[model samples]
Target: MIQMIKKLLVIFLALAITSCKTQKATESKDSSQPNVLVFYVDDLRAELGCYGSETAITPNIDKLASDGVMFNKAYTQQAICAPSRMSTLTGLRPETLGVYSIFTPLRKVHKDVVSMPQLFNENGYKTVSIGKVYHHSSDDKKEWSVYYGKEANTYNDPKNIAIIEQLKKEGKNPKGPAFDSADVSDEAYKDGRAAKYAIETLEKLKDDKFLMFVGLSKPHLPFNAPKKYWDLYDKSKFKIPSRKKPEGVYRLSLTKWGELKGYHGIPKEGDLDDDLTRDLIHGYHASVSYIDAQIGKVMQTLEDLDLRKNTMIVFMSDHGYKIGEYGAWCKHSNMEIDTRVPLIISRETNYKKRKAGKTSDALVENVDIFSTLVDVCDLKFAPVSDGKSLIPVIDNPQQKWDEAAYSVYARGKKIMGVTTTDGNWRYTEWRNSNTHEILGAELYEHKNSLLSYENVSGKGNYKSVEQRMKKLLEIKFPSNGEPFLQNDK
Candidate 1:
């Protein structure tokens, strides 16, 4: 009986060993696949050192760009937060999803739409969302296996908040010049905490397949940053942009410049004065530096874990911001300043093949991010993407590109503007939503000249250019209620 029991024990142990070996083999195969790490920022424009910004103190981002494909002319589908994010995550345009403003949630429009993270999740990836991946916190709940939450908030010292409140009692909005340079630890801000949590998550998921997305919220509003970063830039050296509302443009194409007005010390009624503009620009630069530090934290963790070779890092902003450009303060226009953003795709292959640090002047859109990742990770399942895959350009920086980018911004049934960029030119038309009447049209030449500073649409010298671009615009963005556009295909 004892000998029989021993033989049975040996058989059981053999079975257990076989099972363990099978599981280990599977894990080893899965681990060989490249991981995706996305660093999505809010309101970051094409102003990094990699993009030729002499003023930005972005070392980590510059390094990432050095080891990645830096897109020189990347634009967003929409300049606003919700619409841009919707188009980016769903791989569809805002018009197709009916997401034009921040009022609507993505699920309310397309509840089961496969998001970028959701696609990865379905493909056996342990998807993670660190912060503000979508504009609304709970819009796409099914996408993430680990949702770190959009725990983004504007935090200020109690003394500042109290002063603002006291001023509010006197009918003053009490914005402290639209900025704060508090002498505090990086942990005092939400972005710092985001980086910390992201680093910890990287350590936890080091052995597994992960799509770890870390969203950094900074340089958005009130331009809050730690004093250490604020000290990086000298306020006296700040230069106000050459203020020029695109000439020959329709009057309706101009906005009332409303974003920064909510601040306590901001002018309640007009564009910022020279002094205020200088200070605001300085604040924005400080905020950029602050966010750069947080990025360095997670990237260092990634490198320390020796995960660089088996990981792909994507760094991008939802849309670009107008930092006093065209005297515009925020991102709500069809101008290049608002539409053009920074996009860097860093693959381990680029580093290994000695083909990294290449810049592509290819006109790319934010929506293309979905397809690009799908192609990179070889994801089995994916939603039909409105944007095209950028892997071709990634493989060869000198490849021929579309030289085109499209964007739109609409305000209710009152007015809507659809913009199209071809090569060095941008053409935008504002139309009355109720009657489909043209309110205004603008055309700006960007090659070897001031970008968007002058509108040549009304000039006879560019009549043919305008006519051709108008035709391209109509073809790219068809009339509403028509077959949805899939031009990238």
Candidate 2:
């Protein structure tokens, strides 16, 4: 008995010693995991300096694109904000989310889904959402370790507040025009406050592996920007787009200008005049510059905390903005200008293949973000996705990819569906949910006109092209009006 006891005691001590060494090694590996920072912007399209914009003051954004892999053919799954955000976060399409508008929450419709940040949380990374990561905070409360959300009133000047109050007292709403260029400081805006929060969080999370989402709400509506950004542009340098209705396009494809009509100076029912149109364009450019500066601040903080080297950064907009394109004021259509967005992904020095300063024109979708992050971070999740991983394209930007991208826009069950970049063309079909009949159809040759200002689906010359595009859509989506990922296909 004494001999047996002595042998057991010796084995126990050896096992304990091995366990301590293993624990220490595991802790060291966990601490060295790369941080993730996603800078989500509102209503920013593919109009940055790196994307060949002549008037956009986006030096910092341009620099980010230059240092990262910029996706030239990135498209949002939906043009609407709430649905688009839900799709991107959950790695699901709008149809799968069952949400078509900002009024609906994803949690109500899809309870079993796991969001992008939530996946980081599960992986032992401290997840932090600084501002507007989701359309609503309640969309996914399980995701963030910390969240900072505030009302979007960036124009906090005392004088502007008084003017707004006076207007409210006079029974007049305070939505003064579709744009506001106040001669105030940048910090006076809500986005500036959000940036401050992001900077502070970066400092606190510098020592740990963290996933931070900083969303800036600008260039969305009211085009509100500090006067400094506005002064950067000369009105004479702006050119107003053609406001005429596109030839051969259905009226169903046009927005009724619901958002723009709520503002003060816009016409009740007509296209904006040249001068008003110029200011709106000018205001959008200023807002873009204004938000770009805020992004610069957050990025600088990342560098100050020395987190840049080990951080995997993703900068993207939720959806594309119309900004007077096609005489459209907002994103409520299936147009390429509305569905396409700007997406840039930057990996740290230690990442494989290091496609770090490259650009990929491969067709990609917003929902692919979830899977690509998982691929880069090596995350494993049980949930399936409609989005495919973009790791192949990241490893080789010249790799052949899916020939098309998909997007959905609906005004209550009346769906406008599309499969774009099919041989440099976009094909759209509008269907009535109650009746399985096709209500409308559109086809645009993007190579002929980068902006599909003219619709050619009705033309006899493009009849076969239309058929081919329609068949592509049918193969990807089911005819039963509900959307599900057919992975085997």
Candidate 3:
């Protein structure tokens, strides 16, 4: 009887251990799954006070950065709006996907390519987008489970149409209103409406499990905002960037690239006089502050709805924009200000309780966003993805990652360009599409020349450094006999 009792006890112990293991595995999987909210901004640079900028007042964004892991050297795979957005959504390099310009829609690339929202939706997450998540207004409807706002901005409102007609009569720039703080109304602006709609949806879907995309369109073009926001910044307090032009800097004309001239309007070199420059800076700052206020509203709503503890918030821009940096006022350039954007990720409290107010200098790219979201949500993903999950970095900020960030721009079928950065060295090369002729080359060492005013591409001092960077670029990009040579002409 004692021997029989011993055998039964041993068997019961074994079964208990197996059951415990199964329960632990199930809990681990559940802990990894978290709701995601991507707060995407348009044409925003790393100019916030949190990212070492002293002037711009972005309180809400700064708060988000302080409470999460801030990526100090994050880059967009492309500088343009459409290509950059497409790259982030698809987790593929712009060059590899053959989407190097804004004219082409994402549908043209791969009809069945899984986007971030689509992937999440397939994995049992309710995906929805508010405002301008995608490039065009028309494409947003098809990409999201729900879309808010008009298909496109009413550019031809009777008041604006009259202004355009008058400008045409005078042979002046017929774009829109010049830089004016008090002239615009928030209701007329698309961004304000976007914010309103996003808040409403957040309130309506307070209890639903969702992956919500909140897109903010501000500080992009027209630089339009309420006068109150403009009043927040003193014009005299603004200072222009001190970066100088390189000796052989080749300014690629906008027409050649088939892109917009400037983010707002092409103000001539002398058009933005001292007063105008200060006003422009004020307008830009006001727009940022205005956006920050709107973000605050949304954040407050989330907290009030008791969803903050469960939702994972990610705040980032499609790509950076230049506000008088390098004598430029828009994106589409290969400069650091145009390519490097602000990336902040705020995980829910249940995810291992990361150190609050910590910053990570990890070199990350926009493509990583897709895999990060997937891993955070414990969702299944395809084996072949160009981006790696940022889970390791989020859990341990000091994690090591051996990789470089790359961005590409294609003006035409015959014109293609590429940019790569390894946290310190930045290299840009442009080539003709048909003849494969080298058009332009730019190289800058961030440690030595943070502003990138000094081009050390062919200089004797950096010969070895340039060679090493070139090899890394080739290994990553792998040009197929398309003449990957550098040209400074």
Candidate 4:
């Protein structure tokens, strides 16, 4: 009996040792996978030095583009923050998710949808979020393994802070100065703190597989940055754009610049004084340079830790922002300036195929980012996404791509405008939601004009182009007048 007991004990010990080895091997396999680092910026227009903006000083972003492939014609699914971000992270369109407002949380509508971060987390990668990845803090809490979300304020000046406090005491939302050039350290601003968080997180996760999202809130409203960044540009060099609305544009296509009007010094009505306009533009340029410096710090940390070679890095914005274009100060329309964004994707493995430092004019959308990352990382998810993988275009920028990029804007629940652009012509049709009857249509040519200054729908020469764009929109998104749900997937 004693001999038999000894033999069974030996067999049990052997099985335990084998189990330990298997677990170690699995961990090793996961850590061998490439890491993902996303630099998500807010309200950044494609007007950087990399995008041929001669006046903007953005050496960090320019360097990144030189090391990666820059998409010249990237468009967002929507031109607002919450919906645009939701669409990109979910790999679904705004209509599919039924999320058009920031108040609507992600899981509120699509409880079962697998977000991009969640996919990586479930696949054995540690996911981290620093700063403002989502529009709301409570959104997709389960998606991140670690979340450091300390938001910064709009103004750092003592007087502006006092004003904001008084407004809060009066039970009203506070509105501070339109722009602030505080003589403070870089860490005194939002993007600076976010960069520090990202760098620290990188140090902690150097030995493991991680999907790190570093969000930078800059070039947004209340343009505030360190005074050092403010000194990077000449105030006289910035030009205020045209204040006129496009001829024949639907009246509903524009807003009264209400977002900027609420600031402390802005007039409630009428055009901004030319001096104030130049100063606002200067503040914006300073904010961009400030964020660019923050990005540089994070990128330096990645290199110091030897994470760059094994990491897939993507630099993108939530959506484009309109700066004094057509008298619009914010993004809330289907115009090209609002929908177009900057996208740069870089991976060391891309160097094997000579894919680095190139420009792709292929029309791409923000939704395509989700699938592209998945494909590049060799990750797999069960559900098919709405976005097409841009790996093909990345491999060969000259390759033929989809006909156009699409965007939609809802003017309340009653009217919706759907637009399509192919870099040559942009076409839109506003329709009644229930009946899908066309209420208004717009067509703008991009062949010669920098800005779409007029609507030429049904014009003598552009009729065929308008019809083609309309058919493309109809085929891709049929007007069923129903909330598109994932169950329809």
Per-residue lDDT of model 3, residues 62-92, tens digit only: 8888888888888988788887887788887
| Candidate whose TM-score is highest | 4
- Shift in Å, residue 102, candidate 1: 0.9
Candidate 1 segments whose C-alpha is farther than 4 A from its true place: 1-31, 164-177, 349-354, 432-437, 479-489
* Model 3: pairs clashing at backbone N, Cα or C within 3 Å: 414-433, 415-433
Candidate RMSDs in Å, in order, are: 7.8, 6.1, 8.8, 5.7
* lDDT (0 to 1) per candidate: 0.80, 0.79, 0.72, 0.83
- As a whole number from 0 to 100, the lDDT of residue 432 in candidate 2 is 62
Candidate 3, superposed: residue stretches over 4 Å from native: 1-32, 149-174, 183-188, 250-271, 381-383, 432-440, 448-450, 479-489
Which pairs clash in model 2?
154-189, 154-190
Candidate 2 lDDT, 1-489, residue by residue in tens: 999999999999999987775665456348567888898998898899988888898998888887789998899988878888988888988766667778777777666788887777766678887767788768746668988864565554466566677778899988655666677777777787889898888888788888888888888887888889999999887988877677888768878868888876678887878898888889899999999999899888888888888898899999888777777787877887888899998887577677767898798999998888777777644268889888889778888998788887775655545445563788887776544467778888776434866788878888898888877787766456554322110
What's the true lDDT of residue 450 in model 1? Answer: 26
Q: What's the distance in Å from true for residue 428, model 3?
A: 1.9
* Residue 214 shift from truth in candidate 2, angstroms: 0.7
Error of 3 at 220 (Å): 0.3
Per-candidate TM-scores read 0.88, 0.89, 0.84, 0.91
Error of 4 at 389 (Å): 1.3
Which one is best on lDDT?
A: 4
